[model samples]
Every structure is written in structure tokens, then in C-alpha cells.
Target: MKIAFYGSSLLSSYWNGAATYYRGILRELAGRGHDIVFYEPDAFDRQQHRDIDPPEWARVVVYDATPEALLRVMDEAADADVVVKASGVGVFDDELIEGVMQRAKPHALRIFWDVDAAATLDEMRSAPAHPIRRALPDLDMVLTYGGGQPVVDAYRGFGARECIPIYNALDPTTHHPVEPDPRFACDLAFLGNRLPDREARVEEFFLKAAALSPEKSFLIGGNGWDSKAMPANVRHRGHVYTAEHNAFNCSPLAVLNVARDSMAHIGFSPATRVFEAAGAAACLITDAWEGIELFLKPDEEVLVARDGQDVAAHLAALTPGRARSIGQAALARVRAEHSYALRGEQVDQILRDRSASITHRQQQMERA
Candidate 1:
């Protein structure tokens, strides 16, 4: 199958958190012998701050953020077996959605891939007549990065033909354990870009935890967090590169996963950091969210924290050997069931099954 994906920068994780997920799944698909073309906007300063170059597995099309360039990409995208318009493209998303819906080939399976499903559905609920709402039923499938069953049901309620979540998973090739680097060494570490929805949670789960455990060292890594006031025990490393993520995870005694407001509310939504931390065999402590047991077993594979106090308590109680045990359990779990190869295969199976069902129904009608 030839697949065309339009999303955030594939070669840069600068302000594009979805880069790892996109690359992991698409690269695996390419390995399965599917031809893949990734179309990303040339905006967002991603090109300027790119941490990676185009990989050999897929063809990358970097188009100007102009109407003419988009139209050209849309026309080309329609030629593939599947055309995906991912959410948070960071430029002209509304236009891109409309263009894909209007120009895609009749046989192409059109997908609205929502990386931020909770946020998208929240906006839709407040505005029932949003353009994407109107477009959902016409799409072949609605896929999400997170928000498991609730997101699927919400999209189905909106008249979508089908909806499924392609949850974030570890790419062992990219996120396996590495030797700890002194530069990022700390008692606890949290890595996430500062967005409005996540700021309050970061304070609640990260900074407050740092304050409570004043003697313990903490590290914060991501963009847009430099200006925030922090406790003296916490060090902020603005915009840590993707290449350093493994070391960042390993350097910490335990890594933290703080959910954004919408993700926490939606449950089942795990951040990319969770898998990366687990892959690096970092003892993972996460703020409580519903359906979390589906990913990692609480108190066994990962630790669940209710607040800063809870995080502090967990950190205080954890012995070095116990932390290593928990980290190992998480690593084993992700390695067994949550690799990108497995996710890529699941996607391929979904497409194949959906296609077969349609054909079977057509044949039955013809026979009748």
C-alpha cells in the first residue's frame, strides 16, 4: 500500500511532539513494504531547528505554507491508497482538511488522524457545527494518538464511519536504555513542551513535588518553560534534543509523566514520554488518570501519583533497587506489547479488514 501522511515536522521535534510517533509508525509501515510519503509544512521554524534529516524509509515532501503548495500536495496525496490529515499540523489545518476531503480520490481511504483527540473533541462539543464535525462522516476513518474508547465513541457519535486509537508506543530502536549522562542526572525528571493546558499540571505534579522534596534534585526539559519561576532544587533545560531523551530518562532516578488538562480529563491518554521513559528503564511515576491500567500496571510496572504530595511520597519511599525493579517491569511490558512494529501491524490489519468487509458486502449485494 502507498500511504500519504500530512502532519507536523518529521525531521524535527522542536515544537513538534508528534514527530516521534509519526516517524515510528510510518517507518515501520515502510519496512513492511508499504511506500510512504510524508508531507509537512515548511513553517514552524522546524526546518531551521531540525534535529534529524529525512530517513531512507520514506519520501518527505516539504511544501511552502501557501495555498498553491498545499493544493499541489493534496492532489498528489489523493493518488495514494490512504491519505491521512493529522491534527496539529501547526499551519492551515482547516484548509488542509477541506482540501483532502474535496480532492482525495474516490478510492482513497481518507483518515482524520487526531493527535490531540481530547482537545479536538472538547472544542467540537462546545461548537457543534465546527467544520471538522461536518466532515467526519465523509472520512473513511478517524484515528487518534490517545483517548482510547471515549474518543472512539465520541467520533462515532459525530457520524464518523469508524474511529480507533493508535496509542503511543516505544520505538526500541530510538528509545532503549542508554548509560546515564551526568548532565541530566537528577532525582526526578519531567520532559514536555509548555502548552497552556499543561502548565498548571506541571506545577502541580512537577514543581510542587520538587518543592516538597527540597533536598532532592529535579530536572525539567522542554521548550517554553525557561521563563517560569522554579524552586532552587529544580533545573530547567530548555528544548532538550530528541537524541538526548534516552540519556535524559536514564540520568534520572525516576521520571515523571504529567498529563495535560484535556488528556487527564479524557483518561486512557498516555503521553509519549511515558513510553520513552519506560523504554529507557526509568522508574516511571505518573499523575493519576483513568484507564491507565490498560497500558502499565499501577504500583507494579509504574507508580501512580495523585498530587505533588503523592509524588514526593513515592520518591521518598523508593529505594534504588526497588526503583530499578519497577523500571525493569515497565521496560519488559513495553518491549513485549507496545513496540512500533506491533502498532504498524495493527494499522495494516485494520485497513485490510475494513477493505475486506466492504468488498464482502458489495459481493453479497451483487449476488442478491
Candidate 2:
């Protein structure tokens, strides 16, 4: 199949959290003999801070953030067997969604892949005229990187033809165990770009935990935290690139996963970092959210914290041996059950089944 995906940057993880998820899923899909072309905008300084060169698995087209550029890309994407307009392109999103529906060849399958489904659903609820809400009925399928059943149910309620949740999984080749680096050495490290919905939670879960454990060294990575107040024991390393993520995970005594407000409330939405850390065999501590057991075993493969106090308590009593054991267990579990290879196969089957059903329906109509 020839797949054309319009999404946030695939070459940069600068301010875009979905870069790795795109790389993982699309790379796997390409490995299975599909031709993939990723379209991303040159905006928000992402092109200036690209982490990797254009990859071999997928051809990336970086377009200007202009109407003309969008139209050019739309025309180029018209011949794809599958056309995907992913949420959060950061530019001309409405036009892109409508373009995917209108510009693709009549036989091409259209998909709206929501990397942040919880927030998208909330927007649809508040604004009935949202592009996704209007496009749902005509789209062949809605695929999400997170939000399990809640997202599926919500999209169906919004009149989607079909909805499926394809949870984040480890891309072992891209993210796995690496030697620790002294530059990122700390007792606990949290890496996430600061966003409105997630800043408060980061304060409560990460900063407060650092305060509670004054003796422990903490490291903060990601952009937009230059002026945020933090405990004296915490060190801020703004904007850690994707290339250093493995070292950042491995060097920390334990790594933290803080879900955005919407994702935590909706549940079943595991951030891409969880699998990245797990693949590197880093001890994982995540804020409490529902449906974690579906991915990793609590108390054995991962540590769940209800609040800052729980995080502090876990860190205080954690032994080096225990952390190592948990990290190893997580690595084993993800390798066995949550690798991108498995996810790619699942997605392949879904696409094949939907295509066959569409063919069958067209044949029946012809007979009539």
C-alpha cells in the first residue's frame, strides 16, 4: 500500500511529542512492504532542530506553512492507497482534514489518526463544528495512539464510521538500553514539553516530589521551562534532543511519566515516553491513571503514584537492586508483548479487513 500521512514533524521531536510514535508505526508499516510518505510542516522552529536526517524507511516532505504548499502536498497525496490526516499538524489543520476527505482518489481509504484523542474529543463536545467532528462520518476509520475504549466510544458517539485505539509501543531498534551518561545523572528525571494542560500536573507530581525528597537529585528535560520555579535540588536541562533520550533515561535512577490532564482523566492513554523508557530498561514511575495494567504490570514492571507523596515515598524506599529488577522486568514485558512489530501487524490486519469489506460492499451494490 502507498500511505501518505500528514502529521507533525517526523524528523524533529523538538516541541512535537508524536514524532517517535509516527516513526515507530510508520517505520514498521514500511518494513512490511508498504510505501510511506510523511508530510510535515516547516513551522515552530522544528526544522531548525531536527534530531535525525530523513530516514530510509519513509520519504518525508517538509512543506512551508502556507496555503499554496498545502495544496501542492494534497495533489501529491491524491494517488495514495491510504490517506491520513493526523491531528495537531500545527498549521492549517482544518484545511488538511477537509483536503484528505475531498482531494484523495475516490477509492483511497481516509483516516484521521488522533495522537491526542482525549483533547480532540473534548474540543468536539464543546464545538460541534470542529473539523474532526464534521469529518468523522465520512472518514473510513479513526485511529488513536492512546485512549483505549473511552476514545473509541467517544468517536463513535461523534458519528465516526469506525474507531480503533492503537496504543504506543516500543520501537526496540530506535530506543533500547544504552550506557548511562554522567551529564544526565540524577535520582529521578522527568522529560516533557510544557503545555497548559500538563504544567500543573508536572508541578504537583514532579517538582513537589523533588521538594519532598530534598536529598535526591532531580533532572528536568524538555522545552518551555526556563522560568518555572522548581525546588533547589532539581536541575533543568531544557530541550533534550531525541538522540540523547536513551542516555537521559538510562542515567536516571528512575524515570517519570506524567500524563496530560486530559489523558489522565480519560485513562488508557500511555505516553510514548513510557515505552521508550521501558525499552531502555529504565525504572519507570508513572502518575496514577486507569488501564495501565493492560500494558505493564503494576508493582512489578512499573511503579504507580497517586500523588506527589506517593512519588516521594517510592523514591525514598527504592533500593538500587529493586529499581534494576523492575527495569529489567519492564524491558522483558514490552519486548515480548508491546513491540512496534506487533503493533504494525495489528494495524496491517485492520487495514486489510476494512479494504476487503469495502470491496464486498461495492460488489453487492453492483449486483443490485
Candidate 3:
């Protein structure tokens, strides 16, 4: 398929999980001979601080953030078999959404790819400022990175003709288990960028856990987290690189996951970290989430933490043998079902089905 994607930074993929998600799935699609042109609007300073260039596997096209430039690419995107208006890209200006879809509607199958589906849905539900609430009718399909069945059903309820969840997939080559780096070795580690709204959750869940376990060393790795006061037991390592992610995961006695507020509200949404931790064969201690059992077996392959106390308890009680058991079990489950190749294939299947349906309906209309 010749597909065009308007997504978040394809250049600086360091801590932006969306970039990592795109790199994993798109690389698999390209491997299968799909022609992919990913359009990135120059709205952020990622280019000035570029990390990884788009691989030869996919073509990268950067558009100026001007309305004219966006419309021009939308017209170009119209020629594609599938054109996707992905969430993020840091530019969800109402005019851009309207312009791109209006141009692409007649010539191509347009999709709204919500990488952060939970957050997007929350925004759309808010009145007046919701960019996509009014635009949903124009899209041919909706794709989500996570939020399994509930998310798919909610998109359908919002009138999407087709809604599919393509969960954040494991890129085995980059994320598989590696020998622990001595410097990153810690009893518990959490990796996520700090944002204002999520600060309270971090303090309650992450920082409190450190305070509770003064005997164990903890590490916090992400950007925008320097200002937050941390307990003495927790070491702050700002902005972990994607290349070093496997080491970060593998080196930890147990990796902790904290969800965004929206995801927490709409259960079944696991962050890309869960898959990465599992793929790296690291034991995971995550805050309680709904529908978690559907992916990783809680108490067997995964441990649920309700509060800082829970996180501390798990850490204190963990034996190397127990942690190893949890890691191995989770890795086995993820490898069997959640690789990027598998996710890419699932998405391709959905696109094929949608195309077939369109062709069939046209044939029926012509015959009638």
C-alpha cells in the first residue's frame, strides 16, 4: 500500500514515545514493501535538536507549519492509497484538520490515527475547543495505539465507520533484553517525562515509593523533571535515550509504570513502556490499571501497585528468583502476541478489509 502519515516527530525520537511507536510500526510496513511517506510539520524544535533521521525504509517529508504548506501536502496525501492524520505532531490546529481532510476526502481513504487515543478522546469530549469532534465524520477509519476494546467501541459510538486498536508493539531487535549497564543499575526505575497535570500522580505513586523504601535505590529518567523535588533515595537521571532503553529496563530490579490521567480513566490503555519492559525481560511493577489482565497476567507476569506503599512493598519483597520469573513470563507472553511485525500485519489486514468493502459497495451500487 502507498500510505501517507502526518505524525509526531519522525526526527527526534528520543523520549517521545509516539516517535518510537511510528519507527517500530512503519519500519515493519516498509519491510513488507509498502510505500510510506511520513509528513512531519515543522511545528516543534525537534529538527534543530534532531536525534535520529528517518531511516531509508521510509521517506520523510517536512512541511512548514503554514496553512498553505499543510494543504499542499494534504493534496499530495490524497494521491496515496491511505492518508492518515495522526494525533500529536504537536499541531492540532482546527484549520489544519479541516483543510487536510477536505482536500483528501474525494481522492483517498483518510484515517485519523490517534497515537494517544485516550487523551484525544478526552479532548474531543470537551466542548467548543475539541478539534476532532466535528471532524470525525470525514474520516474513513480510526486507529489507536492502545486502549483495547473500550476505545474501539467508543470511537464507533463517536461515529467512526471503522475503529481499530493497534497497540504499541514490541520491536524485538531494539528492545530485547541486554546485559544491565552498571551505571543504570537500580532497585526500581521509572522513565517518563514530567508534565504539570501529571505531577501529583508522580509524587503520590513514584516519589512516595522512594520515600517508603529508603533502603533501596530508585531512579527517575525523563525530561522536564528537574524542578520536581525528589526524596533522597531516588536518583534523577534526566532524559533517557531510546538506544539505552533496554539497559534502563534490564538494569532495574523492577520497572514502574505510571499512566497519563486520561489513560487511567479509560482503562486497558498500557503505555509503550509496559511492552518495552516486557520485551527487555524486565520485571514490571505498574500502578493498577483496568483490563491489564488481558495483556499481562497480574501477580504472575505483572505486579500491581496501588500506591507508594504498594510499590515499596513489592520492591522490599522481591527476590532475584521471583523477579526473574516475572520477567521471563511477561517476555514470553509479549513475544507470542505483541511484536511490531504482528501489529503492522493487523493494521494492514484492517486496511485491506476496508478497501475490499469500499470496492464491493461500489460494485453493488453500479449494479443497482
Candidate 4:
């Protein structure tokens, strides 16, 4: 299948949380002999922080956020077997949603891959006549990064023909344990861009923990934290590139996963960092989120922290041996069930099933 995907940056994870997820899924799909072209806007300084060049598995097309670029994308998308416009492109998203539907119709299979399903649903609820609502019924498939049953139901409520969850998974090949980097070395490390939805959680779960554990070294890797007053124990690295993720995870004594407000409430929404840190065998401490047990067993595979006090207690008491045990267990579980190879197969099957259904409908039409 020739698939054209328009999403956030794939080359640089600069401020894009979906980069690793895209790389993992696309790489696996390409391995299964599918032709993939990724379209990303030249915004967010992603070009300046380019982490890797276009991979042999897929072509990465960086386009300016302009009307001219939209025309070019529409032309390119018309020829694809599947054209997907993922949520949260950080630019011209509303326009892209309409453009993909208008141009890719009657030919390419149209899919709206919602990386942030909860937020999109919230938008739909608040504005029923939004462009996304207008586009929903026309989509051949509505796929989500996470939000399990709730997301599927919400999309279906908007008149989607089909809705599915493509949860974030581990790419062991790219994210296995690596030697720790001294530059990022710390007792606790949190990597995430400072988005409004998650800033409060970062303050409650990450920053406060740092303040409480004054003797422990804490590291933060992401952009948009220059203005915030961080605890003296917490060191901030402006932007961590995609290539350094494994080292960044391993460098810390333990890694933290802070769920954004919407995602935590929606349940089953595991951030990409959760899988990355676990894949690197970093003892993971995550802010409490529903359905966490579905991914990693709390207090076993991952430690669940409800507040700063919980995080501080974990930092104060967790032993090196215990941390290693939890890290290894989490790594083992992810490698077995959450690998990109598994997700790629699921996507392939969904497409095939949809094709069969379409064929059946055509045959029925012929009979009539």
C-alpha cells in the first residue's frame, strides 16, 4: 500500500511528542513492504533541531505552512492508496483536515488519525459544527493513538464509519537500553514539552518532587521552560533531540511520565515517553492515570505516583536493585506485547478488512 501521512515532525522531536510513535509504526509498515511518505510542516524550529535524515523505510517531505504547500500535498495525496491527516500538526490543522477530505475523496482511503483523541473529542463537544465534525462522517477510518473504548465511542458518536485505537508501542530495535550519558545524569528525569494541558501536572508531580527531594538531582528535557521557576535541584535541557532519547532515559536513575490533564482523565492514554523509558530499562515513575494497569502493572512494572509526596517517597526509598527489577519487568512486557511490529500488523489488517468490506458493498450494488 502507498500511504501518505501528514502529521507533526518526524525528523526532529523538538516539540513533537508523536515523533517516536510515527517512526515506530511507519518503520514497521515499511518493513512489511508498504510504501510510506510522511508529510510534516516546516514549523516549530523542527528543521533547526533535525535529529535524523529521511529513513530508507519512508520518505519525509517537509513543506512550508502555505497555500502553495497545500496544493502540492493535495496533488501528492490524490495518488496514494491511503491518505491520513493526523491531529495536532501545530499549524493549519483545520485547513489540512478539510483539504485531505476534499482532495483524497473518491480515490484514496481517507483516515483521520487522532494522536490526541481526548482533546479532539473535547473540541467536538464544545463545537459540534467544527470542520472536524463536518469531516468525520466522510473519513473511511478514524484511528487514535490512545483513549481505548471511550475514544472509539466518541468518534462513532460524531458519525464516523469506523473508529479504532492504535496505542503507542515500543520499538525495541530503536529504543533498547543504551549506555548512560553523564550530561543527562540525574536521580529523576522528565522529558516533555511544556504544553498548557500538562504544565500543572508537571508542577504537581515533577517540580514539587524535585523540591521535596532537595538532595537528589533532577533533570528535565524539553522546550518552553525558560520562564518557569524550577527548583535548584532540577536542571532543564532546552530541547532533547530524538536520537538522544535512549541515552536520556538511561542517564537518569529513574524516568518520570507525567500525563497531561485530558489524557489522564481519558484513561488508556499512555504517553510516548512511557514506552520509551521502559524500553530503555529505566525504572519508570508515572503520575497516576486510569487504565495504567492495562499497560504496566502499578508498583510492579511501574511505580504510580498520585502527587509530589508519592514521588518524593519513591525517590527516597527505591533501591537500585528494586529499580532494576521493575525496569527489566517493564521492558520485558513492552517487548512482548507493545512492539511496533505488532502495531504495524494491526494497521495492515484494518486496511485489508476495510478493503474487503468496500468490495462486498460494490458487489451488492452490482447485484441490485
Question: Model 1, 1-368: lDDT tens per residue?
Answer: 78888898899999999899998899988888889999999997899988789999999999999989988998887678788899999888888888877777766678899999998898898998886898897898898998978899999988999999999999999999999999999999999999999999999999999999998999999999989999999999999999999999998899999999999998999889899999999999999999989999999999999999999999999888999999999999999988998999998888777767756776888899
Which ten contiguous residues of candidate 3 have the minimum total lDDT? Answer: 99-108
Candidates ranked by lDDT, best first? Answer: 2, 1, 4, 3
Candidate 2 stretches with Cα past 4 Å from truth are none
Give each model's clash number.
Answer: 0, 0, 0, 0
Specify the poorest-scoring 10-residue window by lDDT in model 4.
100-109
TM-scores for every candidate against the unseen true structure: 0.96, 0.98, 0.94, 0.97
Write candidate 3's Cα lDDT for 47-86 as tens digits: 7656676689989998888878877777776678777888
For all candidates in order, the CA lDDT equals 0.91, 0.93, 0.83, 0.89
Per-residue lDDT tens digits for candidate 4, residues 1-368, read 89989999889888888988999998988888889999999997888888888899899899998989867886788778788999999998998888877777464678999999999999989997888899987888899999989888888989998899999999988898999899999999999989999999999999999999999999998899988899999898988877789999988888999999999998899999899999999999999988899899998999999999999999999888999999999999999988898999999888767867766777888899
Output the TM-score of candidate 4. 0.97
Each prediction's Cα RMSD?
Answer: 1.6, 0.9, 1.9, 1.3
Task: State model 2's lDDT.
Answer: 0.93
* CA lDDT for candidate 4: 0.89
- Cα error of candidate 1 at position 233, Å: 0.8
Q: What is the lDDT of candidate 1?
A: 0.91
Off by over 4 Å in 3: 105-107, 366-368
Question: Model 3, residue 141: what's the lDDT?
Answer: 84
